[model samples]
Target chain A: MSLTADDVNKIAYLARLGIDTQDTESYAKDLSGMLDLVAQMSNINTDDVAPMAHPLDQVQRLRTDAVSETNNREAFQKIAPQVEAGLYLVPKVIE
Target chain B: MHTKTIAQLAKGLRAGDYSSQELTASYLARIKQHTELNSFITVTEEQALTVAKQADMALATGNAPLLTGIPIAHKDIFCTQGVKTSCGSKMLDNFIAPYNATVVEKLDTAGTVSLGKLNMDEFAMGSSNETSFYGAVHNPWASNTVPGGSSGGSAAAVAARLIPGATGTDTGGSIRQPAALCGITGLKPTYGRVSRFGMIAYASSLDQGGPMTQTAEDAALMLQAMAGFDAQDSTSVEREVPDYSAGLNNSLQGLKIGLPKEFFDDGLNNDMASCIETAINEYKKMGAEIIEVSMPNLKLAIPAYYVIAPAECSANLSRMDGVRFGHRCTDPVDLNDLYIRSRGEGFGTEVKRRILVGTYALSEGYYDAYYIKAQKIRRLISDDFKRALQEVDVIMGPVSPSPAFGIGEKTSDPIEMYLADIYTIAINLAGLPAMSIPAGFIDNKPIGLQIIGNYFAEDKLLNVAHQYQQVTDWHQQTPQGFA
Candidate 1:
């Protein structure tokens, strides 16, 4: 798939990256090259092959349904960009 | 003291040759001398020394274990209880881990001193250390060239003698490739051999933490401490992990080594080929037999990895939304704005590109065409390894197509960067154990011989690497000017 200018723009928007119009051509070119390289898989004859998701075929073992973390709220919130009243603060949505 | 292996250091500490405080200070001093390499993201001198002092006290009381007081560096991806685990991205620049990863707990119980967090590619995405948010790690071999990433810092530190050993995680080729570039020994054990409870996810299925050191024996010593089943990591295997260092001198006589035909194709550099050939010949002299093996699906590994890794990364990173921990945006009009702006400002170019590609591949109409297809191809790659391993005890190949490339050589072209990982990605895709042993030098730059083995065959891989190292001085040779 060749990426159109509009497609590149949409992808950038969805990815939350700010790409100016001038950079679109190069971005499209690069993304196209990467896509072209990745497109090689389409030619392989994997018709009878079952998809392998995990390296091992074993089922995932379950851990006890218990909280492994403690109440380190004060320490945890220290890295937040913006916080108030021990809660992470964001812009008002319903206003 | 600076050049001693981890085992040697541990033995010396045990024999009262030096106190833990003295050993830790020597490493700290070496780290201070090699700041230009940019191997470390942070140096926990105060914490390390305090721990070392306690270790010294324990030694006096005759209560010290093998790892007690040995200073080691951790890749920035492993979460520490209070240390900032950045994963080389500004996205988590201020984020401190609330709990210790299981590996961290194990090491702490062994009494290993925490040197600090090492630098890496952002979210373990890049093949070169240039993508790190902190700075690029210089290959100790050639200052202008890149150390392979995203575990470049760990490899660099060990190569430069700044640290005897360090921990690194491999998703695609992070550990092995960097180890190759830096002329050190690095191992990526079978998928579930080591617990991943505290490791920040890249591609969950492919990620496994291993050791980087100057020799395979040092890697073994470190791996002995790092491996084991952990109830915290659901994927952690419940098998018994043998003492990896116990068989370092094991006979390589009659051991069958497979040279994958695909790995030596046109893309491989002549110098790298010659270096690997020399290493193989050295192994032949040591009584190991070499056989040519074929893995036709090897070519598809890169493409399959690109799809699966990004698809998983997209899902894993979604939890980094501004509403949770990590970097968040300033005042926002709503939660959506908060997430969008925070992510926009947080992630680097390569990371954002991956997230976009991953999201698109998994999107409504493209899921089967991309993600599902990649999964099917992934199986074929694993089967290829299985068939080859049945014929040979271990496989040997070039860790990378060439030695370390110049910084900015392939950064502009992401495809080139992806291709740089061609030789190493298949082992990760297959989820088997592999290691990069310092084979020889190509034009003053180091080349690595990749030793791959069957699942849970870490001991065998280390044995082969250790046997080869015993017969060759490549692991002992140091880069000029630095030495």
Candidate 2:
């Protein structure tokens, strides 16, 4: 259950985080140690066990489909780092 | 006086001893004086004063609720209308929610004055408040030590007497662990007891908002206003919320308390064990019965919680892409960069680590082996609580294995930090109600005794905690330097 440096790199890439190459070795070691602890779960017999999602067995209730809120575009966009014409502007995606 | 409890304050307000404006002003002054603790993310002084004035008018008309005009703080996790709901992450740092969370609305309806939003672990991911984008909260008891988190700010604020009471969300040990470390009362009610609508989701299944206060009765009083069925939150229970404050004085006679043998085994520190034993002995003298019970699956709680919590978090946090809302990258050549840079820049280190682990666990090839397997194990943990509860009315144990550790004690070692939550994570996994009450002090530091109950057993848990407070003065004791 050892996590290789490659595995750590792949995970970091997927998460979009830049980890220093020097730290990768230590992170791999630490992650492998954590995986070893997590690996213990494989020993338990769960053949008949049902996967529990919610704490209660009840069904989710539905609210009316009617609109409870009005458009507050100005108020909503006030927190954006950058915005114009009721549109959120991000980095240019096309050439 | 600043030290008065919520009940006392409410009584005083009723008696015209102090107006809501004065109380609100006192709390605002305290917040200003205690800026070194970094307990608050934002303080709503103008809004608080306006609310206080309205409360004073209501009181003059003799029509105020029990919690009317009492100053309180909300965990940043709960969304407040027109207030920034950052969840301590950079992604939503500038995001002000348009709607109020159910808990906040309920408290506002009760006429409670809002002091501000408290700090927390980013997306409620870490145990220590250091993960917060705002800054870490210092434990009021020991300035150098961390106030245990992700509810660190709420606990520190309440314990420091900056606010009489505050709200906190517990996904893992967020509320109870911090409350224990900060020497206050924090309760995590049954999963469906409190509505989660508008509460920024970390792990939806485990997230619940409750009260962090100076006494069990105060927790109960706040819970009374916070808990109920909400049509907005599909997961909210339809069952009536019992009057939690009504049974605070109930006799503890014939109450069966189960002491899980596993909780007291190795890894249980002597000081914490002694404090718990003393508290249990006091309960015994007050006519309560204690029986030893076994829950073998207790050892698996941490592992199971790690899997389930992250798996859910991976899905929940995916919505933070640099598209509809939240942080965005400055320049992107393509959509992929937009997504990647936005997330990389927005999330903190611990949050990114969790998102990676969760994404890996739920990935195409690993779903069955990790995510699905953890779900099955989650059921076993819940069943363990059910079986143990059938034999006893409540389960008692140490909230954390030890008192507040130094600020950097386990910051570098994730495993060591994870183990700190060993005693508290199981309750969240089982979706049961639990509370951390100030048991006693060890080496001049505070220790907490955990009381766990069956689903919707908040009333009983509070009763036990309240009765314990009646016999002991531990909750009344404050840290020396701060006082």
lDDT of 2 by residue, B251-363 (tens): 99999999999999978978788889999999999898989999898898888888788778978988888776788878776677777778878998778767767777877
Candidate 2 chain B worst ten-residue window by lDDT: B474-483
In candidate 2, which residue ranges exceed 4 Å CA deviation? A12-27, A63-69, A82-85, A89-95
| Residue B161 displacement (Å), model 1 | 0.6
C-alpha RMSD in Å of predicted model 2 compared with the true structure: 1.8
TM-score of each: 0.97, 0.96
lDDT of each residue in A1-95, candidate 1, tens digit only: 78877887787666555565776787777667767777999998878988888899779787679899678888768766678999877677675
Docking class of 2: medium
- Give one digit per residue, the lDDT tens place, for model 1 in B116-165: 99999999999999999898999988899999999999989888888888
Off by over 4 Å in 1: A13-22, A63-74, A83-86
Interface RMSD of 1: 2.0
Give Cα-based local distance difference scores for all models. 0.88, 0.89
Estimate the TM-score for candidate 2: 0.96
